[model samples]
Target: MLDRSRTREGHSPAEALRDTVEFARRAEALGYHRFWVSEHHGVPGVAGSAPTVLAAAVAAATSRIRVGTGGVMLPNHRPLVVAEQFGVLESLFPGRIDMGLGRSVGFTGPVRRALGHDKDDADRFEGQLAELLGYFTGANEVPGLPAEGLRVPAFVLATGAGAGIAARHGLPLVIGAVRGEEPMLRAVRDYRAEFRPSPLAAEPYVVVSLSVAVAATAEEAWRLLVPEAWAMAHSRTRGVFPPLRPAAEVLALPMTARERSLFEQSLRGHLFGTPAEIAESLDALVARTGADEVLVTTSTHDRAALLDSYRLLADAAGGR
Candidate 1:
């Protein structure tokens, strides 16, 4: 399960962080394989700006569930700093820590500047990734900082050119399922075809991340997804990603025709339905994409509904 620590309507960012930790504990108890947090800089709706720090908190809170970044945007920080941070995490949690890296710069130009990342830094992802791996494997060394000699499992947050990067580095690819099926499957195929056996990963492994919402009825599940879909639409149209609002309020808001179109389109990629329905859809997705693992990432306005979605999803995935 992945949590961006979304600050929904009627909730503070602090509350979102606390809720995320609580959610992680519950997910662990419910038998989730891993619980991941995301990194979002200068996004008011998201409170997970420092995934490594938050991961430490999560690791301390839960015993069984593997804790890691959904990913840390590698372009935002120095490769040495990232390695050290994850090295510390791996030392503390031992075999339970993960380091999923991404090439994305901040969402906006100002945010990018604030993070001291240029547009060109994104292009340096492959190099950054190599440097990160070198720290753990003792292949490449920094003069001042010694290699940690810790082997932290690494995953690339795959998208566009990222699949090729992951394949080249021999790291597992983690792609979002929000992209349509054909494109996603094609990306997976390309990743596997191009994969090289490095010291980190000897074979290709793909993890598909799906935005999920399960309920007693499909209608209720769709309701739970509305807040996130609408927020995504608003971000596209207004250039500002605001905190998620109540679904009823979102429905009542007067939106431009284009915004309404975008809202509906955004809803298309999600897997929302009753447990049986979601399970069937997810199974088909896994079969089609040949995903080695499935990761669920969901955010909603209502805290109770959000937790319930995880419960239903866990039940649905148990048989898999």
Candidate 2:
């Protein structure tokens, strides 16, 4: 998981970049497979505005673990530029770069405008994704296109019809499973059914990213998750970015019983508990989804607590 909160809380962008590099290095040392950084614009609680830049830093800082965007919102940028960025990253990192592209703008109108994108941008995301893959695969070299000879391992971040596009292109698919399992399972099925062999990936590969907070006790973990839960609740109701508040403050805020129940249910699929318990839960989740990989996103205000959560998760995954 990426440390979005570090950049959100008084740390400069440079500091957040350096911290991410160090974090990736530590994750590699601890035997984690890949370190993914998310993309969020105009959100004070998330500093990963430029995922590719941070990905390059993490790639340079670590020798083993793969580094990439948990996703880059494809509609916001030119596909060729995206291709070149990942191409350059691949050139630098060789075998350890992943390009996960998402269709969502990840923001509302104002932030999207600030990012130089409009609402119609999302409509073109599918076509742009196709163009991106074409560029990477040397298919867009008819007359005057920037991408003639470039190819990298690309995965699409699918929440809906994007899954079908991933299948058509034969790209690996990563589903954001924060909402529920049904959408994810359907996407997985669609991706697998429509998958066609490609140079980058011949078989279907599915990865799921979800909220996770593990502690010595379930109660402690639940407490740590209050910030995230509250964030979700606020996002659902208010539709704005709120500063990361204390968990006590979160709990103290007025909440209907139904709202509280929704938050609890939202937290259910997450891997939380002691090492052994997490491992068992993780194994079951993987089994249920047949996912090749799982990305854990922990919502914590304390950096130490966040690191400890990842360490415990790594241990649960049978890593030292």
Candidate 3:
């Protein structure tokens, strides 16, 4: 489960964060293997700004569930700093920490400038990743705190050109299952074919991520996606990403042709429906891509319903 700790229309950022911790507990009890939080900066709809800090909170709050970032953007910070943070986390949490890293800097120009990185900084992700791994393996001369001999499982998020990078580093690849299946499948195929064994991993591994909402009926599940879809459309068109609103409220608002088009576009490529429907979809997805794991990232305005969706999904997937 990769939660962004989205703030709803009526909730405060603090409340949203607390909700994430509580949700983590629910997810653990429901048999989830890991609970991951995401990183987002200067986004009105998201409250998960500092992923490592939030991860510490989650780790301290839960005992059995694995905790980590869905990821921390490497281009935005020095690799040594990230290595130190994760080292501390691993020291405290031991085996339950994961280091999911990404190359994204910021969404807009101002945000990028604020982060002290330009767009091209993302091009250095491969080097940054290598350096981060070097710190863990003691390949670097700099003697450090716990960063030098700690092994926190690291996974590379497949953002542009990321599939190749993961393969070259012999790390686990985390790719989205959306934006159509053909391209995603091709990337995974290429990753496996081009993979090189390293100290981190001996074989290619893929974790496919996508938003999923399971309900008693198809319509109910579909409605659960409306909040996120609307928010995405508004962000793309207006440049202002607001909090999630109720589906009924969003449905009643009038949208321009472009907004309507973007709204529908955002709603595509998701897994939603009853348990039987989702079970079939999961089986086909695994058979098609041979994904090692499915990382579910679903968001909605209805908190109780959101929890229900995961519960149903756990029952449907049966600990997979």
Q: List the residue pairs that clash in candidate 2.
A: none
Which of candidates 1 and 2 reaches a greater lDDT?
Answer: 1
Better of 1 and 3 by lDDT: 3
Worst 10 residues of 1 by lDDT: 139-148
lDDT of 3 by residue, 1-320 (tens): 99999999989999999999999999999999999999999999999999999999999999999999999999999888999999999999999999999999898899999988899999999999998898898887775458788878999999669999999999999999555788899999999999999877899999999999999999999999999999999999889889999999999989999999999999999999999999999999899999999999999999999999999999999955
Q: Which of the numbered candidates is closest to the native, going by highest lDDT?
A: 3
Q: Which TM-score value belongs to model 3?
A: 0.98
Residue lDDT tens for model 2, 116-226: 888778778879987887776676753213334555678888876878888887888888665578877877887898999887788998887787777898877777787
Q: Which stretches of candidate 2 lie over 4 Å from their true place?
A: 2-17, 142-150, 254-266
Please tell me which predicted candidate would have the highest TM-score against the true structure. 3
Q: How far in Å is the alpha carbon of 151 misplaced in model 3?
A: 1.2
Winner on lDDT (2 vs 3): 3
TM-scores of all candidate predictions against the true structure: 0.97, 0.89, 0.98
Query: Which residue runs of candidate 3 sit more than 4 Å off their true CA positions?
Result: none
TM-score of 2: 0.89
> Against the hidden true structure, what lDDT does model 1 obtain?
0.90
Q: Which is better, 1 or 3, measured by TM-score?
A: 3
Q: Estimate every model's Cα lDDT from 0 to 1.
A: 0.90, 0.76, 0.93
Model 1 scores a TM of 0.97
